[model samples]
Target: MVLGALGVCALVLGWRALDLQVLQHDFLARQGDLRNLRTEPLAAHRGVITDRANRPLAVSTPVTTLWANPREVLAAREQWVKLSNNPVLNSRTLSQRVEANAGREFIYLARHLAPEQAQQVLDLRVPGIYALTEYRRYYPAGEVTSHLVGFTNIDDVGQEGIELSMDNRLRGTPGRKKVVRDLHGRVIQDIAVLEEAHPGSNVTLSIDLRLQYLAYRELLAAVTRNRAAGGSAVVLDARTGEVLAMVNQPAYNPNNRSGVQTAALRNRAITDVFEPGSTIKPLTVAAALESGLVSVNSTVDTRPGTIRVANKTIRDHRNYGVIDITTVLTKSSNVGTTKLALAMEDHALPAFMEHFGLGTATGIPFPGESDGMLPIRSRWRDIETAALSYGYGVSVTALQLARAYAVIANGGIKVPLSLEKVDQPPQGERIISAEHASALVSMLETVISAEGTARRAKVPGYRVAGKTGTVHKLTAAGYADDRYVALFAGIAPAEDPRIVTVVVVDDPQGQDYYGGLVAAPVFGSIMAGVLRTLNIEPEQPVGTYAGVIDREGRL
Candidate 1:
């Protein structure tokens, strides 16, 4: 009877084993997976950003994140004591944090560690500490291109400037795969991928690093010399409307995150707006020529250098008397520009400005681009009209002014500005007749000649045309009593236009606050450097100077 009972028990045990091994094999396997299997994140690299010359502006480099399973860490107190005491991890505070979150499944011990640093941390072999592969964004150009290239956040997402503007294209999709981790949470076994990672597409911006450095150096010098609040300088390809360099003073390093002010992050060239002052005179002249109401030789009388309209008086630095349109621009005459603005209907000047992209965003792909304020036709008082002509009662970003000048430089086509490198020149809208544009260009050339407002803007080998603007900064109490914004916008090689440059110096504290004195020199230096760096042929031959030096090197 005892033997029979033993046989029955054995048969029952055999049957139970067969049922579990075959009938519920999937369930058994799932149970086994719960403890050892993990869906590990496969990090994808963020795409690199390069300048037009393929020089790396921003790139991603491999990094590691040290994490821990707090529960496991606490369970192994002896190992935990060693890990906590490992000076690199900071013993006392680490011990406290682990104790406080002992129930937690995961915690970050250190983030964004270099390979060497990560290896140093891993060498401790604490029970729960693990290093996960990740990436960190790095900017090669540092503060030089900070405002233009921008930066990314801890999660590798763009936060400002071009990085933010093109975030979608610059961000990669993180993938996942199954993996078996050892008791210490180290990945030990390879498993099937759940999804493949897709890296972001690379971007080639229109920015030329060579030109960018040049602009930065000159702008920094001018701002420091003048003791200005801040400054911005922009360089654009006049033919294709590509922004080659956009720089601002008081910039911050993107690679460093400590003590950075919000104001320093602003890309002033595209976002900040100021009254353009006399810089608008060239556009007003171009409008008059476009309307066929005046020739390039159209003359305005300004015997006293002042004009009165609607209880307000507009005046120039001195009496320009009677001057032709070209001389009017060269002198930056407020009275002459007022007459030109009022020559037509009240809305004509504003309409012309709108067509030139004034008081409007330049349509750049940057964030926080301001569309400068412009009044509607209904608000056009005589004083307002006069002020608008001379760039008051209106505001524009430096980029907008650069684009408007580029349109004139390119012979009347208003091409869409591009931040990315464009393969082909865009077919543009004709904002003005080519004849009118040419006439305006010829008139602007006078501004760089002797006796003009911006004579300092001239380059010896290349003809330059630009306008000077000194506008009072608007305050809560109205125009400021002392603050002023000095501006210079110019086109180079007037015979065959190539680049447009705009320099803005905000509230220069130096005794010389005029645009001609404070900003024109910056424009000249940037233009000359850019022209030479691009290998653009000089408009003036080697011996084009009127007087030759004697053998003693005396002129």
Candidate 2:
């Protein structure tokens, strides 16, 4: 009786254990499905970028991807051979195919497949082969807008320029849906809704396509004429801080990105910095006049063209005698600007620099703004101060120089530079008195006259105030070669300034490498085209543009 009772208990325990193990299998499988299932990141379409006129600069286009699950491919080896012959794949040998197909149960055959190629693969119905939907960023303007629109990586991430800066807003969220598959590996009814992605917002830039083309053409011509290593140009609306056009040459093809790292691909206008040379003279003169150190008629003792200060001999490009402060700028006299800068407290200069947006990013909203160097006043020597007066011992990006001119063009108010559309204009701080600014404008107008250096910069229908600069390129050790950076920074229609431009030709090699010849003509050509494109009525009256600069080079 005791043995029978023990056997019965053992049987009951055995039966209970089997029931618990088998009956709980369903719960374990559900937990596994929760842990193992996942959704991969899919890049949502990037928004289109258009010029102010709503012409496409960049747009996202539909593309397809080629993928394969080797395990699912039950096709004969010969059929696999035919599919591998695709030019995109370029598999010549069976060994290559085996090596490529080795190890991975699933592999991506190609990304960004052309529609035709993808369709061909689909028609073949090559079992394991599949096509995935994707999108690609395309610059419809082609090389015309590459520098501004920029290109994305294969992963559709913006890498530079406006693309990088506005990437977060331009790259939309992605969506996913979970579904159960049949034994044949086909998607069935939706098991779960993973997420829905929001599309990226469109970006509208301040650039006008017509002006952009003009600027690009002029810059290209300047580079070719000067035999320069590279060049950059920018045009800004003086009344409004709108950037109409910008170009940095030795550019790249965004559509084909294999050689994107070329040195010229860099945006010299906003990214690179250099000693501004005499292009900065107008600012110093403006500062002097604003501080009441001198008037436009103030006579600076610039006799002898050279002066010794703090163990350094400060010399001009050439000497001038007893020139007024205005002539000092007209002739770009280094000694005169030095004397004027010396009269002001050394520390007060930084205030002007700050107002003009030098030594700081202009915040133009492009990527890689170089905050050019400006040392403390206390660290300056007499020679350094003199150098600073003539735009040396200081480095400033091209955009910064344009900003300074913008302040003068705007009648002493220095507004922040902008790239996007603004419903309401931004306010600016007063940097100089309006009278002083007008005085400076009068001086700059002389720069484009026959008696001045930049004779090529004259606009027949308008008065232009501008400055010319030529500086030696710096090497690791010091300034090297006769390779110079020739530049002109100008404002048009000084009576009612409307646009500010800065043009620089890097390492110009021809006889016409001086700013007067190399860069000034470019400014003229660009302004002429842009003015007509924007329908900016010539201040000089109809047919006056042709006479802006007479055949004899007299203003």
Candidate 3:
């Protein structure tokens, strides 16, 4: 009887063991996994941003973030107090602050800690406290490239400029893995990776750091010397349409954005639009030349320096009398440009302007890129036409003017502008006949001659072709008499144009506010340095480029 009883017990035990290990294996295994398994996030690093020459503009460095489970941390007040008063938290009062949020399931104690700092927190050995490995963006170029490179928020997310525009390419995708964990939420067993982490791909911009610094220095000086509100300068490769340099005044350091205003945050080169003044005259001249209304040598009578049209009077600085089309541009005669516009068929000037990439966004990859305003009326009146001719009715950003000039410098080919480095030059669309473009180039060249408005724009070793503009600021009460936007757009080595630059000085307060006096020198100085740095040979004799002019009374 004893042997039989023992046999029954052994048989019952064997059957129960089989039921748990094999018969009900699926359900039992799932129950075990639910209790011990967890999905963990695998951190990935953001890609570095570099210039065309691979110089670092923005990069990410390893950092640690301190997090705590409030429920668990409330029991370790002493350790919590110690951490709150630590230098890594940058606070002697954080202990009280943390107590206020004790009801939260999780809270951040400190963020962006150095490895050593994070280790010190770990040394506290508080329950439910943890450190997460993360990255913090660091901008080496700082304020110099702030407007272009932009910056990420404290959460490591992009908020402006290239960072915002290319967020997908700059931000890495976090991965996941399954792991066995202890009751305290610490990983105990390694498990299979659910997916591999995808790090962000690096970005290469067309910006030349050397040229960017040059533009930044010169623009800052111009703004300071003139006591102007602000300024912007753009340099573009005529051959490839690459933005070599873009700089703006009143810049802010992105690395530390304390007390920075939204006004200083704007990337003014592409976002801010203003009346281009006489800068649009070149496009108007191109339209007239293309419409068979005039040739490069055809003359317009600008006598008396002023004319009345449709209840408005457009005037030049002084009487230019009758002058050739080239001379009209050389003098930037508003009367002459108006006459050219009046000669064209209706919708001619605006149509040509649109084809030159005006009144539209340049399709650059940036946020808040503005498409400048153009008259939406089906037909423009005579005064409207005249104003548009001299760059008043229509508005444009500095980048648009640079690109428009680039079209002429590129022999009438309109290449799409780019902020990224292109391996090859983009195929361009012809906006005007090559012959007409050549004629326009010749006319533009004379604008830097002894008798023209921008004589100071002549580069010592390069044949510079450019125009100057001085437009009265348009206020809520109409055009302001005391404020002006001084502008200059020029091309270097006019024979074989390589680069086009545009400079805009806003609200110059000095006695000399004309574009030639204020903006042309900046253009000349920047282009001269650019040519020398690039080793571009001079197209003209050094002594042949000098000119003298009266500093006052310039249009």
Best by lDDT: 3
Task: Record all residue pairs in model 3 with backbone atoms less than 3 Å apart, i.e. clashing.
Answer: none
Provide TM-scores for the models.
Answer: 0.93, 0.87, 0.89
| Candidate 3 TM-score versus the reference | 0.89
Instruction: Predict model 2's lDDT versus the native.
Output: 0.79
lDDT of each: 0.88, 0.79, 0.88
Q: Can you tell me which runs of candidate 2 are displaced by over 4 Å?
A: 1-43, 74-78, 88-105, 178-194, 317-319, 545-555
lDDT of 1 by residue, 1-555 (tens): 899999999999889998899888889889878978999889999899999999999999989898888888777778755655455676576688788888898888888988888787688787878889999999999999999999999999999988999999999999999999876677889899999999998999999999999999999999999899999999999888899999998899999969998899899988899999999888888888888778876788987988999998888889989898888888888899899888877688899899999878888899999998777767578888888889998889999999999999999999999999999998998999888888777878887776677777767678888888999999999999799999999988888887999999999998789898889889988998999999989878736644543322223
Better candidate number, 1 or 2, judged by TM-score: 1
Off by over 4 Å in 3: 1-39, 78-85, 90-98, 178-192, 540-555
Task: State, as a TM-score between 0 and 1, how close model 2 is to the true structure.
Answer: 0.87
lDDT score, candidate 3: 0.88
lDDT of 3 by residue, 1-555 (tens): 999999999999999999999999999999989978878777877889999999999999989888877777667666555555666653344455457777887788788989898888677666667777788999998999999999998778889898999999999988888999775556789798997888898999999999999999999999999999999999999889999999998899998999999899998998999999998899999999899999877899998999999888888889989999998998889999999999888888888899999999999998998999887779888888888999988989999999999999999999989999999999999999989988888898888887788877868878889999999999999999899999999998888888999999999998889999999999989999899888898876776645543464232
**Order of models, best lDDT first:** 3, 1, 2
